[model samples]
Target chain A: MLEDIVLGLGMIFTPENLFWAFFGVACGIVVGAIPGLSDTMAIVLFLPFTYYLSPIAGIALLMGLSKGGNFGGSIPAVLFNIPGTPQAMVTTFDGYPLAQKGLAGKALNTALLSSVIADACSDLILIFLAAPVAALALRIGPPEYTAIIFFSVVIIAVMAGNDPCMGILSVGLGLLLSTVGTDPHSGSPRFIFGFYELADGISLMPMVIGLLAFSEALRQAYGWLKRQAEGREEPPVHIPGNQGLRWQEFKQIAPTIARSTGIGACIGIIPGIGTTVGSYLSYLAAKKCSKNPERFGQGALEGIAASEAGNNAVNGPNLIPLVTLGIPGNLAAALVLGAFMMKGLIPGPTFMQNHAQLLYALFTLLFFSNLFTFILGKFLVRYAGTLGSIPETLLISMVFVFCVIGAYAANSSLFDVFLMFAFGLLGLALTALKFNLPTMLVAFFLGALLEGKVRQSLAISNGDFMIFFTRPVALVFISLALAMMVYTFAKGFSRRRHTMSH
Target chain B: MIRGKRLLGLGVLVFCLLLWFLIIPNQTEGKTGAEFPRLIVLFLAIPGAVLLLRSGAATGAAPLKGEELYALRRTALLLALVCVYMLVIPKLGFYTSSILGMAAFLYCLGVRTPLQIILTPLISVGLMYLGLGLGLSFRMPAGLLP
Candidate 1:
């Protein structure tokens, strides 16, 4: 192992590997900052380009892009209340509020610092603990998967909106929307509404771009116009003195970054449960552990640290299941697995013995990519701060156009554009109604997986519902979810009582 | 606000019923296909009921008026403009539709400066061409425009 590590380090320090890592990180930040584009899309786009390069250099490039994209997403989420990726939604809760308070620089830097820290920790874990962790991940069956997702949904619903009921309703609506298109078990169309495009159900790109980006543009436009009516000029986003994350601030959020990294790494090893859930669960856990939980959705630096660290930490560990079990943990990991297959390096039990040096080299490259993400992310923070100076009207108009392009480009379908517009309007309404839009979107993202797991668990049990309770891991998660819900209700009751007494 | 919340709850209940009785039967086949959706409908109805029961105690804020109303109208106009843009894109193509849409968006936002209006769309479209066209090589919709 020591010899392999040494050889791997030597292999990765080459000029070609270093250059591709740098280039990939640079492009990733740019691609990830855009609303409709994702790391997955970027990986797919650049996968062919990797064919011309050496295997290590090519894989290094993809790894760098994946890591850089993780942090790049927070730039938009912090600055504009628009998440560049679905998982970054958690960041927008406090990040955008911090930006509005003229602490965009501090928020961005906190996100970057935590991202790098958590990513490095997870990479170290991936390097040393892949086999054992992959074995643990294998023990998670459909019942356990369903329980975990259900627990996440319940926690998010209870914590998301001002009214817990509204959050649950939002989640329910999202789940219902997800139930559109074909029924997976029956192989029959459920709610196509006669549009053949609807056969695949809702595409995520349009839904996310519409809900976050386009709706945000509309909201900003309305606010700017309203301020114009009142003859008030909107203030610039970043205040000069409030721009940096002090060492003391970093010290404060270090524990949060650590805790969230743990959560993210644990979740990442399990296939299908994604970064969005990791970040949200971490955010909720952070809130639960904080001295003042109410400060979370406001301008809290700890919140940013928890979210960014949580999401970015998932990247390294997400590839573990792929490398050790030949099962991709998520879409990004699946794409990376594709890159592996392209290089004729099949990942499975025997893969380690066959290509130990090469695998270790790739793992070594992940650490270097983290360094690249930090340097490149610093430049992105500075650039995004300057963008805050652009006039609100012009910036929002451009964002709206970008949203349109992004939605359209996803499938080059006019129907998708229409879907984006519809969802944009729905977003506007939901915001006005005080529903938690992120909870809704996350629920939409996970609903299919949860449903499939639940149904599969039931099938395995011969339609017996006792399967969930009989399974120890599943029972533990279910109990935790119930405890959380009860606690939330009790807290709400006490708060209401205190208000009345006062 | 309370009224709206109540209405939202009622809407949820109504949809739950519609989905359970009408949409699920019409759209889905086989026994298992509708089972999961039925469970979800039940899940949705509980929150709807809870919202209805609890919202009566919630305080309401003053309704939109004056500048808020005007701002809403402006947003509506902007949405309508986007709708029009989407309709025209397949007919007039991405570049032409986007240029027209951008100009209209600026005008709607009360930016009457002719140079700003003309230049913003041109620059935006030009950048889009460079990025999506040349860089990513996406085949943007070229409708009737040569």
Candidate 2:
């Protein structure tokens, strides 16, 4: 192991590997900051470019992409409340509020700091616990995964939205829409109504871009024009918060950051849950633990730290299962798994024994990539305020153009763009209905998978519902979900009772 | 207001139930295909029904003002442009449609500066064209240029 570490360290710090890693981080930040783009797409787009490079450089580039993209996603989420990726959605809860308070710089700093700290710590966890964690992950099956989804959805719904009923409705609405594509189990289309474009279910880029970014643009435009009619001819100039990230700010959020890092890292080691779940769960956890829970969605710094740390923490341990068990944790890791195969490296149980040097080398590059992200992120945060300061007219139209390009480019389908526009209207309606968008988007992301897991679990048990109670892990998550639901309802009831008395 | 919106929510829920339990089942093959959506729809209906029942008990926030309605109208206009832009892209190309759409919105929003109007479109379109088309190699929908 010592020999492998030395050899791996030798290969990683080479000029070629370092340069490509830097280049990858640069590209990743740009791609991730765009509303419609995702890290998975960025990695896929750059996968071919890695073919001619050495194995270390190639792998390093992808790693850097994942790492950089994770942080880049938080930028727009903080500044515009338009998350660049699904995981960054949690960032918007406090991020946009903080931006409204002109604390964009502070929020961005907290995000950057939290992301780097959690990410680096999770990398350490990966280096130490990849094998054991991967073993544990291997034991998780459809039942446990479904229970996890249930737990996550319930927790998010109960905790995040303004109204619990509305949140559940939003989730249900998302699930209803999610059923539009082909059935997961039977491979038959469900609600297409003869539209060929609906065959693949809904494309994610359009749905996400529409629900979060495009709808936000619409909401802003609505607010803008409304204010205009009310006699305010100009939008407020978004002056960034002058309180630069002081040590006191970092110190205050440090504990939350630490806790969320562990949460995110653990979630990442689990297969299939992915970064969005990790971040949301972490955000919920942070809120629950905060003394000022009511201050959470109202620009709490801990909120930004928890979310950014939580999502970024996924970057390291997401590779744990892929490296040790050959099971990719999420879509981006799946693309990396392809890169692993393309390079003639089969990543499984024997991979560690055979390619210990290469593994260590990649770890070395990961450390350097974090350093690059830190330096680069500091620079990006300085300019992030300007992004929000652009004229409302120009900004909204620009965002729209990108939305179109993003939706269209996802599948080269004009239908996808239409879907985005439709979902935007749906989002507007949801907002009007007092239903939060995050619940719907997160639920949509997990809806099909949740259904697939449940069906698969049922199939495995020959249609017996008792199997969920039979497995320890599955039972734990299911119980947690049930408990959370009851607790949430009870809390809401008491709060309503108190308010009625007042 | 809460009670009225509850009816709207109720109407949506009823439509959803029909779509999921009736229309969707007919389109699918077997129990496996329909069961999941049915389960979700069932889950949805419970909360929706509960919300509808409780709607009369709760007094929600104040209603929208006239300016708010005007804003919705303007926002709908912007949204309509998005729809038109999608349709136009297939025939007019991404660049042409995007430029026109951006220019249209700029003027509609009362931006009179030519540089701001023209420069925004040029920068936005060029950035998208180069990055999406060149960098990512995503094939645009067929149009006059492509």
Candidate 3:
């Protein structure tokens, strides 16, 4: 372990790895500052670049992107009431209102500080917890691993937000997509749709680029066109005063930040829930526990702190499941998993046994990446005001170009570009129809893992369905999923009833 | 809104039933040991769809406002621009395609200045090339010019 830590430290300190880490963070910040792009989309757009990099460098880049993106997302939420990432949705509850009050700088500072602090805490937890978790996981066979994946997917389905049915459909679609390539087990072509490119299956990069990045660009363009037609001018960019972090503000929000970070880290460690949900949940918890819950959406510092901390905390522990079990916690981690495979590093139970030094190096890199964000985020946030001032029309078009380029670059295929557009249309249609895209995206992300695990579990049980229930861990997860689903439905029903009564 | 919800619900229900009948059965046959778990998906999807449909019908009763329709139109225009960008990028080269795309977008957004048009497109294209080419090491398509 000592040797591994030493190796880890050495890997991170290297000039090349350090350069990539810094570069990734900067790029992530830029992407996050842009109104439509999220951290996941940014990471996905950049995944192809990592193909040429070493495993440490690649991991470092992604870690930095995740860290920086989390903070960067708050910029738009604070400035224009637009969230760059779903996680940033909570930020807009207070951030934009604070900006309106000429406290944009203060809001940005608090968010950046909270994010860096939360990310650092989460990384510390990951550094300590990952090794032990991997060690324990090494003892588990295929059946156990399979059960864990199933449990994670089920949890994701239940918690994907607002629409469990849409989530299920999304999972089904994701599973169907995952099956398009050559079957890993049987090597049989399941649903290639007579396309040779699909023989290897649809690349996740293009699909993500299209759905998140391009679709968003399209949405923005529509707004731009509408504004033109209605002769509505872009709102003047307001520069706020220095009104940076005050002692009184800090005193109020510090406890909230700490508590939210803890909550965010715990939620992040769980697979499938992702950062967005973590942020919203933390925001709710903070609001509920606050001395002034009514102040939440009216420019409360605690609100921004809780939301930013919650989302940023997800950076470290989201990698926990992926590194320890080779099970990706979300789509970004799934891309990282792809990177690991590309680097000839299998990231499962045996990962530690085979690559302890590298794993430790990854942990160290993750730690340093957060530190980098802590230092750089302050400087970046000072200039974050400029982000809101960029001409929306130009920015929107540029994003569209990037989305196209990103999709085409993924496989160097025009068909993938077309596929992206098709998915964009599907996404837009779904949004118009009021179907929940997050649930669908989450479901799709989990579907393959669910399928693989369930099949493996059944194979171990000799086709017995009772194995899922018999295992204590699996049963606990399933029960939790069921409970959450029931609770969500009940809450929705009561809310509806109350609304009707009112 | 309620009608829309009901329609969506009915669509999901029908879709699930079709999958169960048409897709699942065909895949299930002649597959010996440990077939991929379809039951969980079916269990979740079928009932979930029904529930959603019912809930949607119960909730989606709000009439669409003018603002909502306007927002929808805006969204559609944005989608159209994206489609054009995708189609044009490969044929026109990154710089030309991006500049043209940016100009069109600016025009759509009510930028009428010729200088603004010229400057925005040129600066956008140059910076993009510099960023992607020199900084990120991505080889943006250099279409026509060798």
Candidate 4:
């Protein structure tokens, strides 16, 4: 193993690999900085370009791309109060407020610093602990998978929103939406409403862009018009020049970064639970532990650290299940799965055993990609900070166009654009109701996976309701989930009683 | 405002009930398709019932104040415009429809400045053209446009 590691390190320091890693990171930053384009889209677009590179270099390029993209998303979220992707949504909670305070550069730098720290640490964890975790995960059957997922989601629902009922409502609604289109096992369409495009269920890209970006455009427009109604020209934004993170600021958020990185790495190994959930759960944990939790959603630097670190950290360990168990953790990992298969590297237990040297080389390349991200991120942060100076009206208008273009480009379908617009309306309505939109989106993301697991478990048991209890792992998780729900309800009930008396 | 929120809550309750009825007869190919959806809807009805029952206590939620109502109406109008924008895109093509949509959107957003009214759409269209034409190499949908 040591020899393999040594050999891999020696193979990775080549100029061609290093150059591709740098180039991939640079391109990824640009793609992620854009409102509609995402890391997944960037990889799909650039996959063909990696045909000639060695597997180590190719994977390295892809790794750098994802890392750069992870941090790049913060650029827009901070500047515009609009998340570039769902994974960056938590960043907007503190990021946009920080940008409003004329600290956009500082926010970007904090995001970058936390991203590097978490990503590098998580990569180390992936290198050392992947084998054991993968072995453990291999034992997780359909029953266990369903129980674990149920437990996690119930906790997520309970902890995510201002009120527990609203959180559950949002998650329920999301799961319902996920039931649209065809049932995966049945090949039967549920609620297509006669549209052929609904066959594949609702595409994630249109819904995400519509819910976050397009609705944001409309919201900004409304706010701008309201400002005009008040007969006040909006105050010009003050974009600071030297917006880099100071050591003092870094020191303050270091603990939050460390905590969120640990949280993110742990979540990363779980199949189908992606960066968005990791970031959100970490943000929740950070807020819960913080002395001044009220400052979190407003503009706390620690909020930025927790969110960026949590999301970015998942980049490394998310591949663990994919490479070791042939289980793609999320959509992004699935694409990486394709890239691996395309490179003639079939990932499973045998592949890991055989490609130990190459795997170590890929790991080495990823470790260095963090350095490239940090160096290049410094310069890009400056460029992103300048976006604050652009007129809100013009920027909003451009974003509107991009939202349309992005929706169309996703499948080259006008049907997607219409779907995007409909989701935009739904988003606006949810916002008006003050609903927990992120919970809905996340639940929607996880709903299909959860449903499939539960149904499969049932099928295997011949519809026996007690089968879950038969599996020790499943029994443990299901009990934990029920206890969590009961505990949360009890806690909320007591809190409400206390508040009413006060 | 309180009445509006009360109506919203009541509407949700009714919608869930209606959806429950709709799901009853709907047969799916997979064994779990109908069953899983039933479970989700049943879970959903709990919160739906909670909202309905609790609507009486929450009188302050999203009160329909004049400004707030106007904002909602404007948002509705924006949604309507987007629907129209979708319809016209296939008719007038992406470039023409996008420019038209942007101009109208800016107008609705109260951009009275002539320069902004003209420049926002033009600059946006130019960028879109470069992006679609060169970046993705996507062929423009030429409907009525040359």
| Best model number under DockQ | 1
Q: What TM-score do all the candidates reach, one by one?
A: 0.73, 0.72, 0.87, 0.74
Question: TM-score of the candidate numbered 1?
Answer: 0.73
> Where does the lowest 10-residue lDDT sum fall in candidate 2 chain A?
A233-242
Candidate 4 segments exceeding 4 Å error: A1-111, A231-369, A381-385, B1-16, B27-33, B52-74
| lDDT for each candidate structure | 0.79, 0.77, 0.74, 0.75
TM-score of candidate 2 to 2 decimals? 0.72
lDDT of 3 at A77: 87
Cα lDDT tens digits for candidate 4, A67-126: 888888887788777676678999999988988888878888888899999999999988
Worst 10 residues of 3 chain A by lDDT: A434-443
- What C-alpha root-mean-square deviation, in Å, does candidate 4 show against the real structure? 6.4
Poorly placed runs, candidate 3 (over 4 Å) = A80-84, A92-103, A231-238, A243-253, A280-300, A341-346, A486-502, B24-29, B32-34, B40-44, B47-49, B52-95, B134-143
**RMSD value for candidate 1:** 7.0
lDDT of 1 at A156: 64
DockQ for all models:
0.60, 0.59, 0.40, 0.42
Off by over 4 Å in 1: A1-115, A122-131, A236-369, A377-385, B55-58
Which one wins by lDDT: 2 or 3?
2
**TM-score result, candidate 4:** 0.74
Q: Each candidate's chain A: what TM-score?
A: 0.64, 0.64, 0.89, 0.68
Q: Model 3, residue A239: displacement in angstroms?
A: 2.2
- Choose 2 or 4, whichever is better by lDDT: 2
Query: Between candidates 2 and 3, which one is better according to DockQ?
Result: 2
